[model samples]
Structure formats: C-alpha cells, structure tokens
Target: MSVVILTIKISHFINHVNKMLGKVNEEDLKSVIDNTKRLTGNLARISDNLDEKEIANLIKSAVAKS
Candidate 1:
C-alpha cells in the first residue's frame, strides 16, 4: 500500500518537474541519467575511505562542475 502511494507521488513529482523544466529532450534526459550513475559510483567509492567533510566537499565540487 505504502509503495503504491509512494510510486504515484513520485510519478506526479516527475511530471511536475518536467513541466517546470520545459520538457527535456529524450537524449538530454538519458545523458543526465548516465552522468548521475557515474556520480553515484564515485560517491560509493569515496564513501569507503573518505570522512564526512571530504564527502561533503566532493559533492560540492561535483555540483559546481556539473
């Protein structure tokens, strides 16, 4: 029950985001997802040996570069 509600809410949220962002092209969306996957991989690797401050700094740097 909770999962279904969460899925519907998430679907609505994504539609809202698309409307606000002016409709991203399919290729652009795919590229964004690819980049996010790479970022998540980096975060996972960093988490293994990095401290909290270091992880925060990494995220800030990634946001700036992105």
Candidate 2:
C-alpha cells in the first residue's frame, strides 16, 4: 500500500477504537497512533514497498512495543 493508504488505515483504526469505547486516555491513544505510524514508515523503508505480511508485521511490532 502507499503511504497515503497506510495513513488512512491507521486513522481508521484510531477512529474505530475511539468510537467503540468511551473515555479513552488521550496520551495512550496518541502513543499507539504514533508508534503505529513509525512502524509503518520503518517497514516501508525496509522493503521499499508494501505487502500484507509487511504491514501486518509492522502493526504487530508496534503494538508489541507499546
């Protein structure tokens, strides 16, 4: 996927999470979002391309880090 698409996906996830639960901690949510974006950027640079597995791994690693 392109950076634009990846960014959209991340935004969607954040919105979805926010909608599903009330009273989320702003700092924690932002941390997750930032880590996700960082991981996506790293994986994109690593492969210079996007694939399902790469995207999945990037998300997994970011979540794990958090």
Candidate 3:
C-alpha cells in the first residue's frame, strides 16, 4: 500500500514538474524515463545484496548528480 501511494505521489510530482518546465523535448523525456526504468529494475534485482548504508549512498549520489 505504501509503495503504491508513493508511486502515485511521485508520478504526480513528475507530471507537475513537466508542466512547469513547459515545452520539453519528447526525446529527452523518453530518454530519462527509459533510464529511470532501467535503473529501478536493476536496483530491484540487486536490492537484497545491498546494505541500507550502500543504498542510502547510492540515493545521495544520484540526487547530487541530478
């Protein structure tokens, strides 16, 4: 339930951001979506092998880069 709610909230936030940005290039948006999907899938498959600290660091790194 929490995962579903969080996904919905994140989707809404992405939509809001997209609207605010206005006139986004379709190819760039598609590339970002594709990369995000690939990253999430890879993370899900390897999550059991990662510790909480490693996961937190990965999130921090990604956030910093973005």
Pick the TM-score winner: 1
* Candidate achieving higher TM-score, 1 or 3: 1
Clash pairs for candidate 1: none
TM-score of each: 0.61, 0.43, 0.54
Cα lDDT tens digits for candidate 1, 1-66: 699999999999999998966777888988999989997998898899999999999889978997
Which regions in candidate 2 have their CA more than 4 angstroms from the true location?
Answer: 1-19, 49-66
Give the total clashing residue pairs for model 2. 0
Estimate every model's Cα lDDT from 0 to 1.
Answer: 0.90, 0.84, 0.89
lDDT of model number 3 = 0.89
- Total clashing pairs for each candidate: 0, 0, 0
RMSD of each: 4.5, 10.5, 7.5
lDDT of 3 by residue, 1-66 (tens): 699999999999999998966878888888989999999998887688898889889889989999
What is candidate 2's lDDT per residue for 1-66, written digit by digit as tens? Answer: 999999999999999987866676778879989988996678768776777888789779868998
How do the candidates rank by TM-score, highest first?
1, 3, 2
